[model samples]
Target chain A: MSDLRSGSNLEKVLKAGHFAFTGECGPPKGANLEHLKEKFMPLKDIVDAVNITDNQTAVVRMSSWAASTILIQNGLEPNFQMVCRDRNRLAIQSDILGVYAMGVRNMLCLSGDHQSFGNHPQAKNVYDIDSMQLIALVKKMRDEGKFMNDEEIDGPPRLFIGAASNPFADPFEFRVYRLAMKIAAGADFIQTQCIYNMKKFREFMKMAVDMGLHEKCHILAGVTPMKSVGMAQYMAKSVPGMDVPEALIQRLRDAGKGKVAEEGIKFAIEQIEEFKEMEGVAGVHLMAIEWEHRVPEIAERAGMLPRPKI
Target chain B: MIVANPKPISEILDMIKDLKKILILGCKGCVTVCNVGGAKEVGILASTLKIARIKGGNPVDITERTLERQCDPEYIAQVKDIVHDFDGVISMACGVGPQFLSEAYPKQRFFPAVDTTFFGGAVQHGIWAERCAGCGTCIIHYFDGMCPIARCSKSLMNGPCGGSAGGKCEISKDVDCIWDMIVRKKMEQGRLDDLVRFKPSKDWRTARDGGPRRSIREELVI
Candidate 1:
């Protein structure tokens, strides 16, 4: 029998040996379920699991947990995300139990954007524990059935744990070791920052593969399809911790006016094709972002449609 | 060293609005070094408070005193004799000044005139930046002499946290990304391996997490 730890469809797909494909969604800034569902409806059958980002970009939005529960109600599996930015450990543990009780099975841990970068710059931040510690804490609760205080949990949530990695982030040589640390801290899988610097990513994967990181945890490459030349330039110049090479930017510019979106999709398709064969890459995580409407076509054109059912 | 900024004059005036007389106590400690509180500042504050009170049509008596160090019990004790004369003492030092004064003269109310900010040193003349968090343990050597606990907006032990851009923190262009500096320094020295190694989850028990930390020196104990 397959381990099927969380019983998450994403876990089932990955364990079943079919290359996994995941999609991302941002909860509406308010409790507008209609807007949230509009984004999810198109992605329901297209990807293995729909990842609901937690206050993405540190901007206040509908809670990722609430969105994930709503996704479950909409008949879609949710990969709920948690950030160690606004909550302390006590709240974090309680929410994990609460989300699990509400039927959420997959969880992504992240060190959220500092509160200073958000709408509430004046707000006090509570990092109580970082994402690395969060991964270990969750793993402990799931595997040992114990809390941070060592008290036993009556029924531990068996979660398929995930984490975010940015291979392009600084101290370039240390990115792989950081991945290893996350895995050691009990991350079962990782979905990295958006893929653009293929050469750097290839080198990063080489190091990860040499360390046999693939054998320890599933690695998913993050793919964001650029919407315009402006978006590419913004990401290349302003967006922190991302590496968008000049060649890709020039390619988008060369696509000429009105054709950037398709050109962007084409670039994403190319990256996905490369990820399919890349060593140590088990899948592609398409973060369609505010551009959720384009996911169905992107997945279809990329031939990832009809998500593998476990 | 401690770093602090003076509270707005309007706020301080509001704090003692009902009082007839008060003392503006300054500290010749970190606050003096930061140019926030000192003997010279005490004269300026005493004059300003008197002027504000006179302008309000309510003349009031004021005393100006600068303690060598408001954090020390000996310096706080020097004002014990005259504390009974004033309705309250406005401490122009860091939060510690008021706290120490309050502890020494429990009957006399001490209002902090300055907000205690952080433990830091001046980066340039008239420009001070935080450098330490007094977490009770020092790990600066591990991070290329940079204190992430006090510098990084997130206090990440292992991070640039995906929000670093153009060598500046996501908080603002003014806050230099300490991780960037650490990385650049290490990489320059061909010591990238130092950063790649795992820095274990901090034992915060010794940090503020343990709550109200204290230090006792057995050998120096009288």
Candidate 2:
């Protein structure tokens, strides 16, 4: 009924301080093995964990399992993402066990992008179970030591399960409420959708405090810097439920043309500084997108220096 | 087959309002293939609506059920006894299914769970590409089994547009140029020259721009 092992790694990370570092990388489209090795090397010592996106935005990418295998082989921590849209219960449960064997210790369960949102608009979404049910299923697998098929695992995964939350997108009151359900379903930590409004995020933190969720789960605020004004507009309009505050827009606007990259880093660091003081805010997940090199600068500026000792 | 479109959670929650007895209906037909109306969708929609409604201070009684087919009269007849038990019926079927259900049971108020999108067939495992425009015309023989009107990005009668690069559409790297597939198919079948043959511009009258199109055959009517 309880997962002492699931929370053990996260517990160690959380105790290091109220500050931590995480990053996300969208897997390349092709199956080039060198691409995997190249992507993980830059990420190894820099991040506490690196997230391997599974066919993000519905574009065809290498399987997260295969990519994670390479990451684990390279002695890097892989935060594997598994979406319910592509597989059924049979495949999901089996894959969870298989990935554990490959030494992928962290997982982020998601409902996934609608097929309509993906490049393949016509693909079927096999949401055999929603993210909540999948979370519960994983927890059940860990606690009971059996999969959905009622088969016993040789060694159940010591998975530090994480779930996603889009505070900017979900209704203000409901966002924290939904996150509470994810925590209740056994999400060890929360990796939010891209964070744009630090002021609004502070308000969300206040609400999380009110709901007692701040005490219950580790919250990793997500930040992805905008590459251009065009990209900022694209994220605001195209990414469903993503909010880009006027201050951020104005900062980029004031930075003028071609200087938006500089403005984006400034904005992200500002968010990181603000996030530092919030109680129960476990850490920050900095998704540099393609520009991972700028991460050390952002972390240095945010005062998240020195690798977290866990 | 029942085909229904997904409605936003807010919209569905609004429809239920203060209704205590709610039934979430699902169709295991075209809607299932489309991922909008099915047993799984019914469960998800029901759970989401329940959570949202409960949070909004109005408690709702939610029960989910899915039928093999919604349009068929036999399946429609099965829900009659149970229809009166719920305050309202949320029909997760094609536009036609709910209309038929309403016609069959005039006493019950029916609400459609899904918005009907289109009539199409599955192009791949999860992707269903539109094939027929319901224009009441058949041109499969002329185009060598490829429907330019439906599949072509630009609806080009003769294509392989300059925009196509490496079989990907120029509009976005994601979309496959349907014409590219056609050309490759034609060449594979030794009919590359067949595409060059003159075919007049498509008649607009047959398409929706002219008016609604219909087909009737007296011999099949009996």
Candidate 3:
């Protein structure tokens, strides 16, 4: 619909009038490259781009850049996720260039999960720049080839900047406005936190559409397939900004023993189908966290497969 | 005001172990308000230290004193007359008290008895909550009086950063997610437009990120 400025496959797919599909992969806690690639093996042909998480949930992990570089070596495009919790503006800007030089085109800027949630709760946080400013910082870097200090870069890292939105977070009415803010800050795409509250998500999407945010940026609904009834209960209770409704938990419980994952996938398929026609939704971001093997089945069942090739 | 907690008695005992005599100085300012290093706390700490030292086969003579404010030079000067009576001073005010006392009496060693946690006010009588980070620049007007810089564990301006669950922070169930509060405040005030655009990167230079900051009021200066 517009000139492909970001040049990311995820961007390309969305721009070319195709509903995009993205997957996620967290770098392992240790630097085991073979283990990393084995995880990506299932995701290689399953989705258009893989979101390489940076210390996801604030747990210490192998760097997203390192994991993404390996993914690139395996021929899978990566959506590099950079969080603002551990790094300040300087490290963030430097890493942007480093990851881009290493062939990471898709970038997701996030205000990372707090360090307290991770193994390093004693670690001093460096949230010198939040996600909103990070979005602007990237916009400045990409459009003007400049740093946050108004300094110029030699060869600007042309990255497809993405941001995260949690529609389930409190004050539901403001979630759409926050998404609008991220878009206004120059996000090319958005991947939300996992969804189980479709009713709330729809209301959020309706507001986003009302604000014409979908016209501005690609919004991908995050879906995490509940592997079991226990997983559903855990997400419903523990996960932050995740709105796993009790009914969904009940449905997962009703799935009985081995069929829970499929039930969760079926629910995801339903969400994807609704998102396919939903006014503001551009795609679904399948976050089968530690369950990468199910991506192919989930994608195929959701009718997102034969992963739209340009 | 600075809210702080008293250091563990074990740590305090370790700090003053070798000293046979020490002063337990308290501040009537923030520490007093926070119920940490107040006059009442000074007596308790002095008694505790007395017992801990006696048990360790080294009885320490502890003199308890409470100043108007340990952070003020004038209040610190009040201790000058009796300063040499002890080998060292265990200042029970927040981290600032020890430093101030140390600066005033360079020869007398000062150990911080309380851990300075945050610039906050009292939520309840015994409960103190962090409300300000002393980031130098104030933007609380934007968030309906809630300061994300101080309250949010991450100090996120564009937040509810995915880890906020049921109005609680991901770090702990005890902490109320400030962004959640801000959002609710905005919605209550019907000011959704306030958050509709990209809030620019915080000018951290104005914050503690710039370095040790100082505010000089020209008119108030002598």
Top candidate when judged by lDDT against the true structure: 1
Q: After superposition, how far is residue A139 of candidate 2 from its true place, in Å?
A: 0.8
Candidate 2 residues A248-279, lDDT tens each?
A: 77778789878999888888887877777776
Interface RMSD of 3: 1.6
Give a tens-digit lDDT track for model 3, residues B75-188. 899989999889888888888888888888888888989888999888887888889888888999878899998999888887767677778887888999998888877778
Tens-digit lDDT string for candidate 1 (A1-310): 2577788888988888778999999999898979998989889888989999888878999999999999998889999999999898899999999999999999999999887667887888888788888998999999999998899999999999999899987667767878888898889889999989999999999999999999888999999999999999998877778899999999999999999999999999999999999999999999987888889999888888778876
Which candidate, 2 or 3, has the higher lDDT? 3
Return the lDDT, model 1, position A6.
Answer: 87
Candidate 3 lDDT by residue in tens digits, A175-238: 7777888898899999998888888888888888887888989999888888888888887777
Q: Rank the models by lDDT, top first.
A: 1, 3, 2
Q: Which stretches of candidate 1 lie over 4 Å from their true place?
A: B18-20, B50-61, B137-146, B181-200, B203-206, B209-222
Judged by DockQ relative to the true structure, which candidate is superior, 1 or 2? 1
* Predicted candidate 1 versus true structure: per-residue lDDT over B1-222, tens digit per residue: 788887898998999999998888999998889988888888888888899999999877998989899888988889888998999889989888889888888899888888889999999998999999887789999998999888988888877677776678877879898988887888789996787665756777788889988889999989
Write candidate 2's Cα lDDT for B151-171 as tens digits.
654455534433344566544
Cand. 3 Cα-lDDT? 0.86
Which regions of candidate 2 fall more than 4 Å away from where they truly are? A1-4, A7-11, A149-151, B1-222
DockQ of each: 0.50, 0.02, 0.70
The C-alpha RMSD in Å for every predicted model, in order, reads 2.7, 24.3, 1.9
Clashes (N, CA, C under 3 Å) per candidate: 0, 6, 1
Q: Give model 3's clash tally.
A: 1
